[model samples]
Target: MSSPQASPAASVRADVWLWAARFFKTRSLAKQAIDGGKVQLNDASCKPAKAVSVGDRLRIGRGEERLEVEVLGLSEQRGPAPQAQALYRESEASLAAREAAKAQRKLVGAMAPPMRPDKHARRELRRLKDSM
Candidate 1:
């Protein structure tokens, strides 16, 4: 009988791929994202255990950053960054869009509100909330 370690195949679980690719820090985080519909296979959201193979497409949304990648290979074990990166290829358009979004964020950084409101500002915010 084949052991569990001998079960590697041409395809791999969606969550494991994400973790190995360094997209998520842990398998749990990747699984959580899958459950929350933040990860999609071939343009449709899929379960964490869904088998992902080479040539398959994926859409992943992290915070405000969205990514589209094409699977190039599969690995049953997690590896170093360079090796993990070999498993997928990001589309040029997706890379460009991410870059543009990053640029926009940098340009608008100075316009964002302070981290925390001052005591007077907080009082004003409370007054505004009370009126509603």
Candidate 2:
């Protein structure tokens, strides 16, 4: 009988982990962003070569979107979306913040009507009637 294969420990390079977990497209891109000081580990900025282990928290920034996640596991190879999702656990605050931002955006979106000028603003009715 063959013995079951043992799984490897959950650990990966910070950049590779980020890329494999879908935080960035390519490992080099992830490294560049991390080296440029765009990524944080447990709230403090970290280097690209830093090792990431399970339970480590990361704060990643992509444009206006900021995501906070805790490393639940690690994978060196880039995999499918479902497998990638197994790597990290997103923070509750991050989810709430995103939802709040969405709601605020909807409220602001409702402020402006489709047309630039309303009927009331189209003409000064009193002036028009007086001229007539």
Candidate 3:
């Protein structure tokens, strides 16, 4: 018997693609952003159901950073970080901005002590609390 015909190329929803690509930590987070109109497709805002295919451009916002990327592949299953990265090509500007943010965070982290109060600070806090 002849093999069944292969199904035509099918695209996944933008939110699903983003989640599968590991762009967002959770599918709901992606959906929330999509519903809130924070994500853009080809420079135009699109809903969560907007289909995504290879070569499509996407602008995603997470926290204080924005990622500008071009889809390079398609997958609906979430995978490792390295594999997820293969699904999209980030722009140079995005990479640079991420690196800069990383560097800034590192510098700030180095300049400050751990957030936990030190013993001396704890004693001072006790004295102040007693006074109050």
Candidate 4:
């Protein structure tokens, strides 16, 4: 007879949730963030292995994006964006803040030049660095 199938998790670790929700690309990165205070649970610092349940609030920060979300569903496996979005609900204030930050960044940042510097420019930079 086939062995009994293992049941799915009702609550998952904080690191796993972050990766599954697409906040961090890898579980290790999620764990690092958890350790470094970039991620919080219910307004308090929590460990990477902390169990997160539905209705619990989370604060996640990555680069320019800062998210305050409430967990709505649980899944251990990562999924597509549409499916992942089902896992949490972002607050209206958080959405507004994110949009405002995006707009401000666009207004303040400059665009890149057409291409990389030529060989002469690279050589000049090398000479300057060596002289220093």
Cα RMSD (Å) per model? 7.0, 5.9, 5.4, 6.7
**Ranking of models by TM-score:** 1, 4, 3, 2
- For 1-132, candidate 2 gives per-residue lDDT tens digits of 311111174467799889888889998899999988889998888998788888899999887677899988777777788878887888999989878988888898899677665678566765687899
Model 2 stretches astray by more than 4 angstroms:
1-10, 109-132
Worst 10 residues of 3 by lDDT: 1-10
Q: What are the per-residue Cα lDDT tens digits for candidate 3 across 10-46? A: 6778998899889788999999999887799999989
Which lDDT values do the candidates have, in the order given? 0.88, 0.81, 0.84, 0.86
Q: Which structure is stronger by lDDT: 2 or 4?
A: 4
Distance from true location, Cα of 85 in model 3, Å: 1.8
The lDDT of model 1 is 0.88
Worst 10-residue stretch by lDDT in candidate 4? 1-10
lDDT of 4 by residue, 1-132 (tens): 321111166688899888888888999999999999999899999999999888899999888799999998786778788877888999999999999999888866656454687999999989999999
